[model samples]
Target: MVINENLKNEIEERERLERLYQNLVEKMPAVSYVMNLEKEFSFTFVSPQIQVLTGWDPKDWIDIEDFRLKCIHPEDVHEFVEALKRSIKNHEPFHHEYRLIHRNGDVVWVEDFASPLLNGNNMVESYQGVILDITNRKKAEAELIYNAYHDVLTGLVNRAYLVERLNQILSRRHPFSEQPLFSLLFMDLDRFKIINDSLGHRIGDQLLIEAAHRLQNNLFPTSTLARFGGDEFVILVEGEDPRRDAVQLADQILLDFQSPFLLDGKTLFTTISLGLVIDNGEYTEPDEVLRDADIAMYRAKARGRACYEVFSKPLLDQVINRHQIEALLRDALKRNEFNLYYQPIVALKDGRVVGFEALIRWITPQHGLIQPSEFISLAEETGLIHQIDRWVMHEACRQVQQWYQYGLSSFPFTVSVNLSGSLLHQGNVVQMISEILAETGISPQSLKIELTESVFLETSPSVNQQIQNIRDLGIQLQIDDFGTGYSSLSYLQRFPITAIKIDRSFISRIDAQYSGTEIVQAIITLAKELGLEIIAEGIETVSQLHWLKEAGCDYGQGYLLYRPMDAESTEKLLRNIGKGDEVM
Candidate 1:
């Protein structure tokens, strides 16, 4: 009786333990699996959760031969098999992540882990493992990768990818590869900023997307296309003959943008400038390729956009020169290397000096006597023009004050200073000029503001308002280097323009052929009709002066009348003029 009770109790306890194990296996999220290695790699036991995880019943794993292999992604099968074998051979634990084709044909990623079940000899026995669904994690990883390499707006490869791929190509090429050359075309869309400023960014984004599609469509299958951010794109063209291909590709790109883009009903027209560099196997860094291509792109833009330029040493030299100028210009004021020279603006009727134009000159310790033509543009680009403009205005005013203090104020001659177009954008421009005149104790009439015709073409209402404020302040407004720009006579009617300085280009072309004579006559006629003054620049010859006088030109200035001189020389000339004597 005692023995029977013991056996019955033991059997019940075993049954309860078995039920607990089954419950654990069924409740777990992962599919628990056991394999028999002595025989073929086959499943001996699999959790019922296999159905929930991979849509396969537990029985299917055991009944079907090589069921896992059949479901394993083809690309990962070898790695999966090798991992299991390695774990069993070494009698150690193992882990791997690989792909599996689900019963519904959707790709599923699984994190597989296995523990080798070895005998006393530590030889092959079997592997017990679990596979947890990691498809969501894999999807997250892929999304991160895509975002890292591609632009979100256009769905094109971004600059990061361009740098990576460019470096890869350059690394694989060696002397034995004969050149293994490629071409990089750097493209920048012209007038894109205007579009962004005029239309909304939403429309601009749409235009960019369409432009990207156009560029990607034109590339060869082997090539790579990437966006360098902000209306700039770079292409890597791979071919045995990359030079010819680059030219053809650039030409095609120009043609592509030639047609207007219709975006949400508005037809917008735009053009692109291309800078191309045919790789000669000399570059080791990716940025060098990009830098050279960028240099060329600017050259294309300089030649007027909708054109292409190939990388050259001279372009690099020009870029270096620009950098030097920018660096020097930034420190020019601080070092007191800047000086002002005055060129007299003469009245054609009596050759009497009516006013003087302040021309800035930089006398650098390293590079002597740098003219405005060499560095003024750089100053404007670097925002140094405002500082320089303020200095010239104050200095000219002070010099005029000095002339008055020294009895050299000849009939209250006015001093004209050219204002950079950038300054007109300043909301405080009128106030700034007002403060400068007030601080110097100079009358506004003695200080004239000179601007290029390009200034009148500015569409800014604020700028026009600013000009009106200057005129209201009793300061004279004149257009310097006129006839070279595209402003119309209507500007004279619109702005408070007191005079127009005809560009030297028109004056220099006067000859027996009467070149530019008609243009001059037209300008003089337009000025006369509007009751505006006209001053001819670059009057190097008597014939030019004679012709200008005959054409009713009111004022002139150049090497012929008076070269740009220092303040002392100009004061002397002013005294001479005060005495009713012409210096010439």
Candidate 2:
């Protein structure tokens, strides 16, 4: 009777433990299952959560033949089957993430984990596994990856992706005798900044989107297009004749841009400048190819927009030379290699010196006596012009102040300094000028500021106010190379300009044979009507001088009147003038 009671207690304990195990399986978030290895990995048992997780009854999992394999996404089925077979054959645990097709035809991502079930003899019997739905996590990961490689505004590949693809192509070795495997085109919209500044960024962004669509639609299906940031784009082209294909595409793009872009109810016109570089066995890195393509693109811009240029050895050499020059220019200012040369402005009526224009000259230790034409534009491009301009202003003012103290001239002669458009656009330009005058103790009236007509093309309210402020400081303002740029007559009346210097191209053709005489005469008449002083530049001949005097031009300056001279020579000339000697 005691043994019978003990057996009854053991049966009760086993039933209680079975009930507890069933409750835990029902409550777990994952679907737990057991597969029979002897029966082609068929399910032997499945938790109740299987129905809630996959919208299928738990009994169907055990009754169906190869239902699990059939439910896996077609793209992931092979990988899933191979992983499962490896795990079963090796008697090891299985861990894999794959997509499954739900009953409703939706893709459900799952993470599957399984371990080999062992029998009493420690031999593998069946596989015990759990499936956890991870669809949201996989979607989040996919979105993150997409955002990393795409441009937010244009919805195109970004620079990172472009470089990555380029690296991949460059890694493959190709024969030197055959044509390149691909071509790279680096292009940018010409005058995009004008549109952005005038119409605002909203319009600019819309235009970029439209441009991206047009470029994509025009290309072959195999081509890859990417937005390289801020109105710049890159394209990778592959074909039997990539060079020819690239050129045709570039031409088509240029032709397409001739059609106006209608953005925000405004019709705008723009052009593209493109650079083409074909793959050669010479380049082993992506940057080298990109650098060459960029160099070619700038060359197209230099040739005027709406064009394309191909990369060549000569172009690469030019770029290298420019880089070397830029490097030298960075140290030129610190080494005191810059000097100012003064060219005298003569009174057309009396042939007497009235003022001098201070011009910058770079005297390098390696290349002696470099002209402004050789380095001024480079300086402006590299933003070193501001430093050079400031130095010239202070040095010229200080020298003129010393000349006054020495009584080198009997009359009040002005010194004019050429200011770049970049300097004129500075917010602190007025304050900088005021400080220079105060430090040098030079009279503001005797220091004239000369600006090119290009500075007036994009003038804003703040820029106008800055000009007025500079004028209020008692400094005179003159427009240099007046007729060479896109300045209108209204600019003269609107700005605080006191004088206009007719461009040299007009003065050089002022002889009786050319129609340039009429242009110069018209300029002089217009200046007189506006009550502005007119100075004729590049008056190299006697006939040009005679014509200027006849036309009532106020001042003239060129090689004929005086060449640019060093400070010591200028001082001697000033002394000679103070003594009433004929120096001109």
Candidate 3:
């Protein structure tokens, strides 16, 4: 009776232990399985969680031959099987992360951990493993990688990815030839800043997105387009004829931009300038290629918007020269290398000097007497024009004040200083001018501000307000080089413009043909109708002067009237004028 009771108690203990093991396996988060090594790794036992993990019944998992192998993702099946075989043969632990196909045909990412189960003879009997679903983690990783390489605004590949791919292509030798044939096209949207400033950043961003779409649609499948930065994009092209393909692509992109972009019910138009560089096996770094392409792009812009230019040695040299000049310009102001030259604006009736236009000249030690045409645009681009403009204004005002101190106040002459559009657009421009006038102690009427017609291209209420404020200070504003810009006639009536100086181009062509004469007559007539002062620029010949006088032009200035002179010469000229001498 004692032996029977002990035997029943042992049987109950064993049954309880078996129940606990089964409960733990079923309750675990992972899918647990035991497979037979001898039967090609077929499952001998699988926990009930197999159905929750892979949508496969535990019974089917155990009954089917090689069911797990068949369910493995085709891409990873061979490696998975080989790893399992190695682990079983070597009696080692198996650990791998791979994809698995669920019964419903969805791909599931899993991290599998298994150990080879050995019998008493030290031979592998079966394998036990657990698969933990890591699908969410894998997706998160993929999303991070994608975001790192793409631009957030345009959803195009960013600069990092482009450089990496370029490096890869450049490092590898071509299969057929020693060097790879490819091209890099750098693009910039023309006058994009005007649009951005006028319409706002939100509209600017939408335009960029639309531009990316248009560019992608026009490109070939083999091309890679990247948003290099604001209003700029770069494309990498590879094919048999990269030059021809790139040119064709550039032409197509320019043509594509001919259509207007519709953003928030507003119709907008923009053009792109392209610089193309065909690989010549000379560039070892991506930056070198990008630099060349950028240089070429600026050349296209110089030629005019909506065009493309190819990289060449001359272009590179010009870029180098420009960079050197730019470096010199930064120090030019501090070194007192800049001087003002005054050209007299004469009255058409008496040929008496009524005003003088202050023009800046850079007298560098290395390259003496640099013209404004060469460095003015560069200064504006580098944001140095603000300083240059202020210097010119103050110096011109002080010089006029000196003239008055020299007893030339009876001359009734005004000094005009040219202002860049960028300088005029500054928020504090009016305040800056106010301070300059106060500090110099020059009469406001003795100073005039000359602006190009381009300044009114995108005028706003604030700009008009600034102009009004300047005019309220008793200073006159004149449009310099008029009739050459895109300003409408309404601008004359809208802004507080005191005068219009016809562009030199029109003046130079005045004696050439009847059409030129007609254009000049029309301008003078328009000025007369509006009661605005008219000044003819670049009057070089006697006939031109005669025509201007006959046409009722109020003022004129050019080589025919007076050449630009240094301060000493100008003061002497003013002194002679004050004494009623025939200086003109």
Candidate 4:
């Protein structure tokens, strides 16, 4: 039949719209479907995505009854069916998530949204729905949740998770009623970092994992052990008699560590220090209790490790004091609280001043004055000695430069500054010295670095090489308090030593004690043979100085000639010496 032009155009328009809708459905990534309301969930239409999403062909599902509902996970089927019922009966849209079993036998998370399709009479006729695969998103969310409470390296509950567990236990009014009187013990390995550094980190990691496993196996059956980070572990025990139990456990732990751990064909020995606290009647916050345990652990280390200690108030107080001092020291370098005092080194033959040793003194405004013995050791303990050493070098260099400007002295003389073992062992010691020299414009020959015996013992070959390299830069190396140490004559032959200072212990009794005189003589003879200059220290009397001069000591320093004085006093004393005052 021939149709009117207007009717023909309308038919073509409707056909074009239907083709567009089909193309959109076929190309969509999500599965789309329509079902009727006769309890017959036939796929009246299905997108091509259905095959990829569910491994089922569109034609296969075309006449299938309730195929989608059958595919829903057994666990989520009730929820899914109830939502579908509400959507159909109330004529409202519904959204839900369920696990879908695909034809490949794999379960996946899928989000479904459906709306009740209505006839022109406003009555529900069918349902149209879309399904989105959200398996990857669900997996990602699960991982994030898991990682939030677990340590990634060890796969153990982290500190945050531990705190949460503690809170859960504490929130209960009867935690100790049947759960057994619980206790938490913190464990730290002694000198663990030395193992990490001397050996590589790989070995250190293996050692830590082995330690964790040992703790797990040997600990009480109900105990939970966790890695608290490098070399630290926490053990939670649920039992009675916690005090005696903790000590016994610590002893067993030490015994287990006594056996050599064979790793990469090497036998390594390790020990641990433990801090334990019983959760008897006293109530304490988790963090506060952990802090007290940490303090006790340090006390264990101080008392010669491989032991355990219970928390005490006095130990915590000491920890607080140490922290306060450390905090103050961090700013002390910037506050200009430190100064250098010079003790003159004199030529015994002519009684003329040759050089000086720069000693550090702290001038705290609040504390009045602090001795080097007090803060210097503290600095070493807190790893602040490197900064303090650098400051001393700069100040000593500046003072020598000042003396040069004064022209009181004809030429720049060696001003010795002490070097801490920590500074010497650092890999960048040579580079630091070179940089400081370049920055200060001080002649390297005029600066002397005094090292003690412990410095040599702690330093590696790389460090020893660095020391030799710096010495080659024209700076002198002097071993201070030489006779006091395992003072070996062999180091003189091995090291490029320029000078040695006889310890005051030998010098103070040179004339009174025969053995002291023999030690002084032997040291002087050795210094001459080794071509190393000798300086006798702590010559407090004229008789001692006379004896030292008779012993052919090249230089001597003591309270007899001059005590350590400020730069101004040192300059004045030197000026007096230039004028030949009180020289016999």
Query: What's the lDDT for all of these models?
Result: 0.86, 0.88, 0.89, 0.80
TM-score each candidate.
Answer: 0.89, 0.89, 0.94, 0.60
Candidates ranked by lDDT:
3, 2, 1, 4
What is the TM-score of candidate 1?
A: 0.89
| Poorly placed runs, candidate 4 (over 4 Å) | 2-27, 35-51, 55-70, 78-91, 117-126, 146-152, 157-160, 163-253, 256-290, 304-308, 327-378, 389-419, 425-461, 467-584
- Which of candidates 2 and 4 is the stronger one according to TM-score? 2
TM for candidate 4 is: 0.60
Judged by lDDT relative to the true structure, which candidate is superior, 3 or 4? Answer: 3
Compared with the true structure, what per-residue lDDT tens digits does model 1 show for residues 1-584? Answer: 99999999999999999999889888989888898875466699999877776777778788888887888899999998898777866777979999988788888999988888777876868888888999999999999999999999999899999999988888788776666478999999987865775577998999899999999889987688999899999999887787888888999999998999999999988889999998876889999999999999988987768999999989999889999878888888999888889999888988778888888888988888887777876777678889999999998888887788888865768889988877887778898898888888988888888898867874467778989998999998989888776667677899998888889998898985556698889989999988889989998988898898988999999998999999888878887778878655
Instruction: Write the number of the candidate with greater TM-score, choosing between 3 and 4.
Output: 3
lDDT of 2: 0.88
- Clash tally, candidates in order: 0, 0, 0, 0
Regions of candidate 2 where Cα sits further than 4 Å from its true position: 1-4, 37-42, 118-125, 188-217, 254-272, 301-307, 488-490, 509-512, 516-529, 546-553, 579-584
Number of the top candidate by lDDT?
A: 3
**Window of ten residues with lowest summed lDDT in model 1:** 454-463
Candidate scoring better on TM-score of 2 and 3: 3
Cα deviation of 169 in candidate 2 (Å)? 1.1
Q: Which stretches of model 3 miss by more than 4 angstroms?
A: 1-10, 119-123, 174-180, 512-515
Looking at model 1, residue 144 earns an lDDT score of 100
lDDT of 2 by residue, 1-584 (tens): 99999999999999999999989989999889998877665689999987877788887888888877777899998998899878867878999999978788888999999999888977788888899999999999989999999999989998889888888877776655566878999999987876786568999999999999999988976689999899999998986888788988999999999899998789888889999998877877889988999999998987867999999999989878788889999999899998889999999999899989998888898878777876888888789999989999999999999999998869999999998777766688998898999999999999999988867766656677888998999999999998887658888898888999999998888665544688888888999999999999998988888888987999999998999999999999998898889545
Residue-by-residue lDDT tens digits, candidate 3, 1-584: 99999999999999999999889998999988888877676788888887988898888777888888888899999899788778877888999999988899999999999888789999888878898999999999999999999999999999999999989878884545744478999999988988898789999999999999999998887899999899999999987777778989998999999889999999998989999999987777899999999999999988867999999999998878889999999999899999999999999998889989999999999998888989998898899999999999999999989988889756689999988788756889999999999999999999999998878766666777888998999999999989877758988998899999998898887773334687888899999999999999999988888888988999999998899999999999887887788445
